[model samples]
Target: MNIPGPEPRSDGGVGAVAAAGGLHTYQLRLHAEYGPVVRFQLPGVETAVSVADPVLLEATAHIDKRPESLFAFLAPLFETGNLQVMPAGEHTPWRRLLLSVLAGRPSHERHFTQFTALATALADRWAERAGRQPVELQKDLTELSLRMICAYALGGDTADPGGIVAAFEEVLTEYLGRLYEVPDGGGREERTRRAEEALAHLRATVDRVVLAHHRGSHPDKSDLIGALVEAGERPARIRDTVMVAMLAAHHTTGVAVSWTLHLLGRHPEVAERVADELDRVLGDRPVPEYADLRRLTYLEMALKESMRLYPPGPYGARETTVALALGDYEIPAGATIFYPFWAVHMNPDYWPEPGTFMPERFTPEEAAKRPRLAYIPFGLGPRSCEGAALAMAEAQLVLAVLLKRFRFRPAPEHEVTPTERFVLWADDIRMTVSPRRTGEEAR
Candidate 1:
């Protein structure tokens, strides 16, 4: 069967996607017009197949190769080649190694204090604002998550946490700003130079931690750098891992929290439920202990539902090594397979009232009735996010603190518009926060 899509244009599929406003909207429109399986041109790739059906996604799950054209921009962030686009054999070991430390209970527990302190510090600063000005959730939260990740990867002895975070911001500014356009005063060259310097500083900080591990001063079960070193990985690879970890953890987790809060502000009734749950679970504690995460069940459900609505990383891609039988169509070997996660999450077949914000959709019983791939905010298969557990822990902890102390209401003057960039973001998420004074006030 011929796959359905718009007629190919002289400019390829760029016009179609751009006219649709971005890939998220484009994929949603594509699937709606042409059904779940649509073959379309993706900017560079002459023809790519996007699979929006969760059941069909199962067959493509084993593919470990990511198409390079879409991921090439991320190459500069790595030293031992791009980890995300590495081959299946190399990626398998690397993913396993990262999961060992990243997904472990000990690792999350080990870093929970630093994480709490960072969240609290941000809350304190917001408290000082006294609701005089609306806070930019994306800006504040991403920086906080960056700090948490840096502290987690480098241990408490990091020389200058502020400088490290600023450096990473520089790197992101360059990479995300399209590398050619200068930010503020600098030319492209100057911006590139600053980003390179920042990347070098990040690598140097990781080297410092690696040296500490070699000296046996940092002995622990949750040491990422130590684990990599113990497994005889190369220095360049260790640096790349930390770099990627910082990049992946900070933005995605930060935006996940922001988008969740964005939704909660719109749906005050749901917000009250989450607040009530937090009140019952924490009992006047401003922050949650690591173990308290499980007890904050409704908060977790709200976060999950938020991610489903505005998934941090909206889509993923892979290169098919062999022919894939996707329902009525056959995807040939070496073709590009685009995973439109945003489309799947809103497929209507799986998610009832897909546009509505209802956190209870994630209650374990409700979720169990759906396909495993039906709700993948972290992605799927071997190349899926290794930091899913850690990201969830970080988002839930941050939300717990902020929601517990403050009640967020959308700034009436500002529109919280969701856009697709590297992550699902808004032009600005301006929300007013006033401290919650009482449990009854929460309800």
Candidate 2:
């Protein structure tokens, strides 16, 4: 059956996507006007099919391949290959290796003290600046997230944390900037030269860490580099995997926590409840132990709800390995399955009052009622993020530390507008931070 969409625009979809804001926003408009399965023009490619229905999403879950062309912009950062589009044969083992360490409770426990330190430091700095200025949540939190990933991926003892963070930022600014046409201080030729230099420095840093892992003879599944080394992955692939992890984990986790706090700022009642949970769980302790995460149930729900409202990575894409039946529709083989995460999240059928921020919707009782794909802050299926567990832990830890120490109020003059960039960026979330009094309520 022919899918419904707007007539092919001569401008190759640029004007349309721009008019609606971005790719995900355009997809939402499509699904709203043309129903769940709507075909639309993606700028670089021909027509793409976007499915916003959860049940339909289940049908395509088995498709493991990602369209490599769409992700080409990130290719310069990877050495071995784009793991995002690695063949199923290669990806399966690589994913297993990553998950073994990244998903492990032991790994989380091992790093908890260090992660807590990083978060506490950020919180302490914010406390000092609390009354002085509206803290830039997006900028400050993303940088913290980058540092946390560097520590997690390369270990805290690695050289020059600030330099590593700066290099990665430079690489991203040069590469991602080109895709979105975002201007930078340096000219294109100069930016490219610097980015290449930064990329080399990062790879060398990973190599140093890998060499240490090899020398220590601690190739354990509970450690990220150790697991890869133990699995006998090629040095290049190991570095590529680490790069990908840092790339995926940093901004995404940073924005997830930032958006959650932004929501709490607007919804003081819910923030009060989150604070109550923190109080009851930690009592007098300022930071949560690794075990305390599960007990921070309300806080977890709030984070999940915030993601539902503003997923860090708004959309995902997969290539059909074969012709597929999606509900009433038959999709052709080799078609691009557009996963409009924001639209699926906002689908009224699964999420009642979809636009509202209701953390209770994520309670076990309520969450059990929705389809698995109904809430995909992280993308779905086999090509889904391997760092999912770690990202959650990182976000929760950061949110706990900051929310415990300070109350975030949206700055009076700052506007928090949701625009899709890197992650579903907030342009910049500037919030007034106030040190929490010992017995302060959310007011």
Candidate 3:
């Protein structure tokens, strides 16, 4: 059988699969047929695809090590000062500081209680809405994740976040749609314009919060903004970095939530198990504390399974600075190498039933048995998501709280199809949520 790559086959066909919108359906379809490395060269765009273990690791590390030019794609979405746009060397110190305060064990533990409370509050609101017909799961998940990020990252309230979140969502979804034309239509240039406009709105809000905090007149807060202001960085860069954190931190998790809900709706068994776990661990509590998260390992596995089948950041790309040999293709220095986590995660060689939703694949023992790079929902190298821990915590909290209170079934004829952008999202998931009876609720 012929493998998927840049090479033309004996059968007359378009060279490498270049669908209308750079959709790489063929890559996922034939990943097992192909070995580890597959390079596709389009006119003016040379891209390499990798599903092999060694190639994926080396490729990720190579980009993470020297990541200045490779981040240009982000310039249109975030200002140049954004951490995602910062050169590798300059970006390192800030990342270290962030990890120390945010992603590390200490901060994660400290914030767990807060997240649990937030989760319960949100789920309570969802319960209130359970009587109001079917809810759009994608919209609900997006709002929930965005609000949490804003509260945590900006240390703000819900009063005005809705509009800002909506604007950010517009720009994100549009950019994901590949609309990059400048001046005339909505495309890359248009996305940059919208992002800047949205940033201006957010900056005004940030300025108010920052100035108030700086006056030594506000109450102490431990949210993301508080963490940044206390970190003591240059004012301008600090503002830009906060914006970067907001964009980078929330979008992936938002998509993850959407995928999680879609998967649970499709697999009632998984939802039942998660709900059962939540009930067994905690009952009648207003909110679960940080300690409860450990008991939900299966929920973590379920999230991992959802991500494996549908990772938020489906594929990552990096432009090479030097020539590289991949498979039968000789890629030049300027080529853009594509590392598709979606394809890699779904390759049957690595995952027993690549297309199924089986959380067992992520059990500690099973995970240990798999290749490290093979599981990169948070990515593999230094450039891996900084907010991964936070995302996971928030996911567990929301899932546990929501499932404990309500049971959801897929809305009639609701289709869950992935629409790709910087993150992969179920186009629009709709679910019928019913409030569980007192006794029927997670016991």
Candidate 4:
């Protein structure tokens, strides 16, 4: 079967999509021009296919192996093995273990108090700054998310939370910068040396955290690190797991919360509705409990809608381990299958007025009508995000605390642009915060 795609550029299709517009936007254009199964060019890969249609995606949903060539850039960050490149035999058990800790209701409840307190502390800071300076949504939220993950996953033994967060950011910025650069660049050697230094700093920090856990500095046996230590996992494997968890936990939730706030800021009516729900649910309380999460239906719907429009990690990819048939096209083994999540969410058939920010789109009645895979912000099938439940809990609780305390409005003359750098991030989501008037304040 023949596949439709644009002519490959002579530059080896390096930065082709990115040059057009960001990768996310370029993908929407691809599906618009060509059909759902559009062939595309990716640097360092032989053949790449982008599947936009949800129906077609089911065919390849079962393939769990990620493309090694694509994920190899992350290998240097790990010691024993790269979780991204783990084969099915190892990946299955590893993922299952992660699910046991991350997906459990008990685990979420265990960490809820610390998570809520951290979120409330940030909200309190924002309340103090209301009407003074615009809040940096992504920066603050990323730090909050990082702190929560460290507390939950590594326990409270971390002596310097700020230093650990800084090291992780340095490693990400250095490696991600090099990953996008042309391989034969002039300053490649210098950049590579800097990346190595960053990696060393991150590894040393992780080593200290792990050693503290083993020495009983953190006695919570149920914590993620403690559980692994009790399971007798290797030190290298434990380090890799912790690093990966930090990498996954930090920015994704931060960006998700950032985008949700951005959307709510633009639509004051929706923000008002969310605020109303929080007021009715929590009443005089500043923070939301685990049980309160289920009662905040409007907040949950708005978050789901936000993810549909601006998924934090905009794309997911897998290498075909065996011959696969998708729609009418036959994808050979060893081919790169790209899942353009942003494009999938924007598919018109699944979502009407996909560009419009309508929280009602996610209401239970409305959602039941659409295809299950139509809304895949966290992905689908076996390799889906294990910490998805945890992320939503964090995002919803933070949104509740922040929104109930202050209203967010887009900062004057500061434009928010979504750029892809391992995650869909807005460097500056500049928004003004004004304290919300409650019953007591109004009286």
Candidate 5:
């Protein structure tokens, strides 16, 4: 079956989708122009098929292998072998272990206090700067998310939080830069050298934490690293796990919260509703407890709706291990099947006024009317984000705490644009915050 797409250009087919701004924008255009299953060319992959229809997504949901070539940029960060290319048999056990640690309610409950405290601390800082300067939403939130993840994963030995965050950022920036750069570009050796240096710094940092834990100097079996150690994973494997978890946890949650706040900033009515919900749920309390999360129903809906409009991880891909039939098309084995989540979320058939920031779209009754796969901010299938529950909990708690304490309005002259850099990121989500008066607020 011939899938519809642009004719490939001679510059290694990069031009097939280059005209549409970034990859995420290109995908939106591809689906808008050529229906659901649009064939395109991606760097390193032969032929890519993007599926936007949620119903059609159900057909290829079970295939779990990622395109290894596409994820090769991450290979340098792992020492016990690349988790991205692990065979299905081995992948299952690894994924199960991750889910047990990351997806369990007990873990989330155990870490709730720490998460809220970190968020509250940041809010306090922002409170100090309340009329002083615009708060850098992505920068500050990413730091908060990093600190939270480190505390949860590595225990109390995270003495050098700045060092760890810097190292991780350096490593990620180096690799992502290479991944997005034109293939066969100049100065390849220098880029490789810098990436290796960053990788080494990250590995060394993880080694110190692991060694400290094992020696009983910083023993904490309740944390993520502790769980992995208890599960009898090797030191090298544990390092890989920690690095990968940090990589996944760091930006995605921060970006999600940032986007949600940006949306709330633009729509004061929605922000007022969120404040009302927070006011009703946590009447006299400053921060929310885990139980309070369930009561913030409207806040949850607004967060979900924000993600539907701007999913942190905009797209997901799986390479077919067998001949896959999606809709009326048969995708050959080894072909890359792209799940353009942004496109799916914007599909007009499922979401009316797909571009509108209407939080009611995610209310329980309205949500039940849509297909299960229609709003997969985390994704679908077995290899989906194992930290979905944890991420949502963290995001909601942070949003609740921040919104209740302060009012966020977008900076006067700042323009926020969504760009894909391994995740949906806006470099300049400049928003001003003002402390809400105790009685005057939430009215």
Candidate 6:
């Protein structure tokens, strides 16, 4: 099949589509301007059409089955045997351990106190810096999220959130930047080296924590590391489990927090409603419990809506290993198919007024009307994010706590746009935070 016209941009801007010879740009522009499914091709690659088509999505369940499509892109950060890279069955044990830690009452109870403490600490910090001071919620939330993960997962906070995060950020930035620049052999090798260096640093940190737990010499340890170490037996599994846990827990939460804040700032009415929801449900409190997450329905809906708009893992790909039938086209073995959620989420056919920041779109009644797979922020079918439930619970708790304490707006004259690499986040968002009190509290 010969696909014609428009290709992925070679210049590689953030949010750029992945195709050859301007195919990504074509798909991005055409999906908005024309219809869902568009034909595109990359130079030196086979002619392949990218589908934001809902009908096509239904026809292809094998999309994420191959690791090479999405996981290969991440190979620089994590090795082939890592949980994210392994075949479905092989990854289950690690997933089970993570699920056991992140799910259930004990984990929730342990995490609730930590989440509240971190949220309170953050709120207090912002309140102290009150007035017209510009506070970067993204940075603050990133720190808070990483800290929570470190404290909860790695025992106490040994991982420097800012420092380690910067190292990983550098790898992602450099690699993604050079990815589209002619695929130079030497450049790719250098990028791979840097990635390995960053991963080695992080892995070493995890190893040290595991070793401390093994030796029974660490104190003040109340996080996931302690929980796993205390479980007894299976030392190697425990180490791999924690490594997977950290990767799963930290980055995704940061992205979710960033997007939640970005959406709240973009939509004042939504933020106000969220605040009201918080007031009605949870009044000023020292900390909130896991059960409290259920009461804040509107806030949860807003998070759902936000995730729908900007799923941190926006684009997922899978390489084909066998001939598959997809709609009218026969997808050959070894072909790569890209699934861009950004395009899928914004498709008007699936979501009316897709670009608008309307939280009500996720209301119970409205939600039941859409296709099951239509709003897959955490992804779909099997292999969906194992921590989806936990992440939502944590996000709701944090959002409630923050909305209750302060009010924020999008930074003036600062355009916040999605910058895509591994996760989608606001490029430059400078927002001022002010303590909110209902007149009587102003004094």
Residues 185-248, model 2: lDDT tens digits: 6577987899999999999988888887878843322277788888898889888988898889
Error of 5 at 268 (Å): 0.5
Error of 5 at 315 (Å): 0.5
Full-model lDDT, candidate 2: 0.88
User: By the lDDT metric, which is better: model 2 or model 3?
Assistant: 2
List where candidate 6 sits over 4 angstroms from the true fold.
1-27, 42-49, 62-64, 67-70, 79-82, 103-105, 157-201, 215-245
lDDT of 1: 0.88
Q: Candidate 6: TM-score?
A: 0.81
Report backbone clashes per prediction. 0, 0, 5, 0, 0, 9
The better-scoring model by TM-score among 3 and 5 is 5
Q: Is candidate 2 or candidate 4 better by TM-score?
A: 2
lDDT of each structure? 0.88, 0.88, 0.67, 0.86, 0.86, 0.66
> Clash pairs of candidate 5?
none
Clashes of 3: 5
User: Residue by residue across 85-199, what tens digits does model 1's lDDT show?
Assistant: 9989989989999999999999899889888999999999999885798999999999998988988888876879999999999999888887222345648788789999999
* Structure candidate 3, residue pairs in collision: 36-52, 179-187, 180-187, 180-188, 181-187
Better candidate number, 2 or 4, judged by lDDT: 2
For 220-289, candidate 6 gives per-residue lDDT tens digits of 4545666666666255555555555555666577678767787887788888888777767666663456
